[model samples]
Target: MKTVGLALAVTLLATVHVVAGDTRFERSLRNLDPSARLEQICDYTAMLRIRASTPFRPDRAVGSASSPAKAASNMLVANGAAFRSRKKWYRLSYTCKTTPDRMKVLAFDYKTGPEIPEEKWNTYGLWR
Candidate 1:
């Protein structure tokens, strides 16, 4: 009985950790209004762009599909890419699967404010 209880406890803990790790992205989106627009800015091919905007806010972030996990917290701005907005800025991470023309932006996250930098971004797949 003791072993069974311990095993069950461990299983529950692991499940919670996985669920928690996945929630950041969902939480970020939850703050947006239903009308917010999520756009596919660029096609795949190691480079891709996605934009999400809300009338209440005008900030956004764009990153490659292979962009690292730390991208979530750091707010990294890709080289040669311009981040535009007068309001707060957001972070967007993506995963490309094919050529630039055939590729597609997979996932991303958004928040208000400038990027934190490569080091500060969370390594978790919050935007994956």
Candidate 2:
């Protein structure tokens, strides 16, 4: 019974994680350049993880803000990223690591910064 319970728990955990990629996210990668694909995967992770972990609902995320992110070899360290939530842009930075094919996000670590001032949005290429 203990073995069965453990197996069941593992199965449920797997199901929840796998369900995140059951959509067209993986399929869409076939059409993008390698670098673009990596960005897409990491951006998707940003939106999904933030929504799941925070009260904010992020619809978009840009990896570049005040400065361009450092992306290389399946890893992206975005120190000046931004995420749009509830029509407001917030400062965001994240380190996202992905698989070789850039189809799966292996890990994502992120921090949300203070709200970007409305007057300064133009400087960062942020929208209203």
Candidate 3:
């Protein structure tokens, strides 16, 4: 239920840091492999993009909540993903597509479900 952003970012930042641009983020992506890179960008996208208005700011995103994310070519789909806003964890699912180089996000879609039960948190490897 947290992030490093790309997987690189998701893997990079254990928690999100407010930034003005992608300069530092871009540099960070260079450190991750392709699969991780895909996760990172998409995870970052989840926190940054959304049409449905929510109250709190999501500070973190996890590519895998109850299961590992699936990747194929330049696309990554994570059905068991989750994100943390303030102190609550919400169910999440996301689909991420990247450019040929797998460095830029070409398209992304995600939906956040209900708040996860605290009792199920440990089972899902979620933390406080």
State which candidate has the highest TM-score.
2
- Considering every candidate listed, which one attains the maximal lDDT? 2
For candidate 2, the TM-score is: 0.79
Q: Report the C-alpha lDDT of model 2 over 1-128, residue by residue, as the tens digit.
A: 99999999999999988777556567788789989888888877898889999999999898887688888999999999999999899999999999998888899999988888888788998886
TM-score for each model: 0.26, 0.79, 0.78
Candidate 1 is scored at a TM of: 0.26
What candidate 2 gets wrong by more than 4 Å, as runs, is: 1-22
Model 1: per-residue Cα lDDT over 1-128, one tens digit each: 99999999999999999689547644654464422212222211112122324433323334432243222221223332223334323443333222222222344333333443444333422231
Question: How many clashes (backbone atoms < 3 Å, residues ≥3 apart in a chain or on different chains) does model 3 have?
Answer: 15
| Minimal lDDT window, size 10, model 1 | 37-46
Clashing pairs in 2: none
Worst 10 residues of 3 by lDDT: 11-20
lDDT of 3 by residue, 54-125 (tens): 665888888898889999999999999988888888889999999967788888888889999989989888
